[model samples]
Target: MRPVASVSFDDLLRAHQGMIRAFLRRLCRNDALADDLAQDAFLIAHQRLGDLRDTGAAKSWLFQIAYNVYAGHARKHARRRELFEAQNGADLDDAAQPAPAGMARDIAMAMDQLPADVRACVLMCLSYGMSHSEASKASGLPLGTVKSHIKRGTEKLRAFLHAYQQA
Candidate 1:
């Protein structure tokens, strides 16, 4: 198979847009924000295409860029939340938008209840179908850590949902 260098970046974008959007949407749980991030990813990919030497790694490379964008966005929001909490003694969850109704919504809510790191792994693996190594590259986390997070996250989600169901 040819490296990603062999394909036009536009062609790459056309081919991967839906998958990228689905990955972001599942991660963000917001369609508009996911679309925005997908656009951001493509723009970043376009700018940095010259830097990548291995065309075969294009998909993973793009995912890593998207993950970086998401991480930056999350950090910015975290800072804002910290400032707000310091000022008003407000909990972050107080401002969280409610989850929508349905099985997906229920699962999303369960995911939300997990620790952040574990939630990231679970979503990357199960929700977005990213393999452990792929999730590791995209998250800047060690492979073992990604594996452990997915394991721990699975246990936690199962427990949480079982409890939620009994209620």
Candidate 2:
């Protein structure tokens, strides 16, 4: 088979752009950041195109790279936030937003409290309608782990929403 690098990078961008953006949005929870990450992902993919083995696996491979980029960005920003908070002695709610109605926002807030890996599994399975196996592949987690995370994440979200309603 011909090398993927031999193909037009623009064609790859056009094909996988939406998936990359959605993946980044879920990871970063910010549309602007997601857009920036999506562009970066495509650039990285283009640069590494020759490394891609299976054309059929290109979508998943691209998503994996995007996930890694978002995870690294999140970790770096988290450290920055800690430093800023230490310097200012004031908590910054960079993520604060007007709560949406009903149970959805409550559920999302609960999901936000989860560990990153668990949250990614939950979002991939519930929000994006991925199967456990698909989520496993996308997240680089085992299928059983993906299922467990979804089950626990759902239970936690439900409990959180119930508590919110009681409040």
Candidate 3:
């Protein structure tokens, strides 16, 4: 395997930025916030590039960093989130950018129903096409837990979008 030093960080950023931002957007349900978090994640990844063991695994490594960054933000803002929810009578998802219609809307709603960790797992696997093991690594979830989250999250989405299936 090539060391991370073999692949320039700029190349990595160019290749993975869109996917990483999309993953963050789905997790946070906010476009602007996702952009900010993605930038932060990339910044951290650049700072820690020396720590990456293999260039081939950069995507997963970046994902892991992004997930951790998001988690940190969530933890740091937990009380603020609660206050916002209390005042707005809605979760942050409700305050996110306007969602698309039809199945997209349904999927977003269903995803919102998932716990953050489960949602992260599901997005990493289904949305980004990461393998279960890759998702496990990225999410810092046990392999079995990542598998379970994907299964259950898929089931929930399927159930929620069942009407679309019939239509």
Q: Which candidate is the best by lDDT?
A: 3
* Per-prediction CA RMSD (Å): 3.2, 4.0, 1.5
**Once model 1 is optimally superposed onto the true structure by TM-score, how far is the C-alpha of residue 147 displaced, in angstroms?**
1.0
TM-score, candidate 3, is 0.92
- lDDT (C-alpha, whole model) for all candidates: 0.78, 0.74, 0.88
Off-target runs (Cα >4 Å) in candidate 1 are 84-99, 161-167
Better of 2 and 3 by TM-score: 3
Ranking by lDDT: 3, 1, 2
Q: lDDT value for candidate 2?
A: 0.74
Candidate 2, residues 107-157, lDDT tens digits: the string is 656666887788888777777666787778877888898899889988988
What does candidate 2 score in Cα RMSD to the true structure? 4.0
As for TM-score, the candidate ahead, 1 or 3, is 3
Clashes of each: 5, 0, 0
Instruction: Report clash pairs, candidate 1.
Output: 3-55, 3-56, 4-55, 4-56, 5-55
